[model samples]
Target: MVSSDESLPQRLPPIDRALDRYPYCIVWTPIPVLTWIFPFIGHMGICMSNGVIRDFAGPYLVTEDNMAFGRPTRYLRLNPKNVDGGSSAWDEGVSKASVLYGTRMHNIFCDNCHSHVATALCNMHYENRTSWNMIILCFWMFVCGKYVNVCGFVKSWLPFLIFISIVVLMAVYF
Candidate 1:
């Protein structure tokens, strides 16, 4: 007899780093001075089912594929299966959020990149929840995100490390 699990869809497409494609994922990149001082803070974007990225880069600008800050150093791959309509629903959610955000002003405190990602997740109703927010998204990404590679890992943390080191040396010396 065939197993019930056999009817379920297979895994999502693989991430292609060279192409900056991360299907069904939330991608993150560190901001220059902000992330160096506070490692948990960074820019975020959501990927379409086909791995294309959509992010609120600035006021009324929702860019595709080209992230505002730079490439993603960490990512949290989400399962399309979690959505009611799977991949198509995931793409629609990202699209809808991008369009909506494109008309809104970008506020570093409230409406920002993290807010954009949260809106997409809420639109998709991932995990049957619609309470996604910047704080929640930020916390989850910081705790669960995986570095794209060794270089990605260094890019995310090295600057923060150097900043801390300098602070410690200054305290000891002067």
Candidate 2:
């Protein structure tokens, strides 16, 4: 019998292929429409803005990737067997990174330390509070398959059209 795991990767839908090969085919892209329709998706941008909370989740994926490169030999692989009661082999590094992330943030910003919240050491903490920017960034990030803000350039009636359509649909259904 053919195993399910063996066929997983082969069935992965290639979204980027069309985007890179034919940029004009963007109208057919399901990604942007999904992002616009889903409000929770934008929450990621909102989440990254608060570094203090994010620190609780351990180093962001970028930081982990950079550190991984420096310790290439120490990297561990995921095992299907780890689904049981025992801890996985990779837990140690992840645990350490979590503590380090929280300590690093708290030591610098416990009290009313406005400066700490604004800038981490020298790097500026992302305070993605502006509603307009958040929506714009979320849209483009969704479209480009990466994080970036691009709503400033869009001031057309497209958003109005979407909102109107949603309201009308709700009215008709309800």
Winner by lDDT = 1
Report the C-alpha lDDT of model 1 over 1-174, residue by residue, as the tens digit: 778786776777989999999999999999999999999999999999999999899999999989999999999999988999988899999999999999999999999999999999999999999999999999899999999999999999999999999999999999
When summed lDDT is taken over every stretch of 10 residues in candidate 2, the lowest stretch is 45-54
- The global C-alpha lDDT for each of the candidates, from Candidate 1 onward, is 0.94, 0.27
Candidate 1 achieves a global lDDT of 0.94
Q: If scored against the real structure, what TM-score would every candidate get?
A: 0.95, 0.19
- Report the lDDT of model 2 for residue 133: 31
Backbone atom clashes (below 3 Å) for every candidate: 0, 2
Candidate 2: where is the Cα deviation over 4 Å? Answer: 1-88, 106-174
Q: Which ten residues in a row have the lowest lDDT in candidate 1?
A: 2-11
Residue-level lDDT of model 2, residues 1-174, one tens digit each, is: 879975665231222321222111111111244325553232220111111111121222213112221111110112222222222212332334343444543221231111221222113112222122333433443455421113322322245468769889999999
Q: Could you tell me which residue pairs clash in candidate 1?
A: none
